[model samples]
Target: MKLFQYDNFPQVTGSRVSLRQILETDIKDLIEISFYDAIRAETVQQAAEMQSKINQDYLDGNSIHWGIVDNANHNIVGTCGYYRGLDKGEGELGCVLLSQYYGQGYMTEGMSLAIDFGLHTLGLKRIWAATGQQNGPAIKLLERLNFVKTADLNDDEIEYELQK
Candidate 1:
C-alpha cells in the first residue's frame, strides 16, 4: 500500500455504485458517461483507444482508474482515479459523471468509495482535487466529502485537499 504500487485497480462496492476497472466491453458505456472527463470520446473506438492509454499508465505503475458503475442497472455512470505523485504519499483525485446522473448522490457515493480506497488501501497521506470555481456541484460535493478548500490556483480553478 504505497504510492503508485497497485497493478490491478481494486474493485469496491457501495450501496449505489461499484468502482472497478473499465473493461473492453465497457467502452461504449464509457463514451456515454464521459462529460467532464479530460478526454472525450464520441465513439467506442475512441473510448477504447483512450482507455488503452490509461490502462498502459496503470500497467506502467503510474496511475489508477476506476469505472463508476451503478449497481441498479449495472451500467457505467462515471469514472474516477488517482494521479500518483511519485513516492510522496499523496495523489490527485479526479472524477466525472454523465450529466443525466447529476444531483442523484451517485457521484457522492462514488467519490466516497474512491476516497476511502485512496486513503485506507493506497496509504496516501493526502488526496487533492482541483475543480473550476464555476462548478457548483463539484465544489459542494468536495465540501460534503470533508475535503478542505486549500487554495485558489487561479481565478477560475480552485483546489481542495483531504488528509488522514
Candidate 2:
C-alpha cells in the first residue's frame, strides 16, 4: 500500500517529544547522530548517503521516517519510522536515539506514536523490528510495547513483532 500520499506529513506528539517530518536542515544533526556507535555512519560521505536515502525512500513510497525531536529545545534527538515490508499487510519499525537520550523514555514515546500510525492509519496487520541482540534497552522497550520475540535474524540480531 502507498502510505505517504500526504501534502503535510502527520506529526505525532507526546509530552516530551514529537515525531515530525525529516527536514533538509536536519542534515547536520543527522550526521552527528550517525557518529554514535549504535548508528555508525562514520564519515561525512556516509552520513550524506544516509540522509539521501531517507529523503528518497519517502519519495519512493517505501517508508515514512520522522525525526524524534525534543519539544522544549526543538533538537532532533533521534529518529523512528516504518518501512513497507515485502508482505502487503506488514511494515518494519526502526528507531535510533543518541546515547544521552537512551534511558529517558523518549524513544519509547516516539515509538508509540509511530506504531499507532502504522497500525491505525496505515492499516497494517503487523509491525515488526529487528535489533542487535546486544541492544538490551531496545529489546526491553519493544517488549514493553507488546512486541513478541519471534526469531533470531542472525547471531547479532533478534526480531520482534506486534500484531494488529
Q: Pick the candidate with the highest TM-score.
A: 1
- RMSD to the true structure for each prediction, in A, is 2.6, 2.8
Off by over 4 Å in 2: 1-3, 35-39
Candidate 2, 31-147: lDDT as tens digits: 656532246686667777776777677777777789999999998989988765824767889888877777888898899988988888878888999989998898999999999
Q: Any runs in candidate 1 off by more than 4 Å, and if so which?
A: 1-8, 32-37
Q: Best candidate, lDDT-wise?
A: 1
Candidate 1 C-alpha lDDT tens digits along 1-164: 33354445689999889999988987776686543246567887788888888887777766788999999999888898886663677788888898788888988999999989878887778899999999998999999998888999976899999845
Q: In model 2, which residue pairs have backbone atoms overlapping below 3 Å? A: none
Please give the clash total of every predicted structure, in order.
0, 0
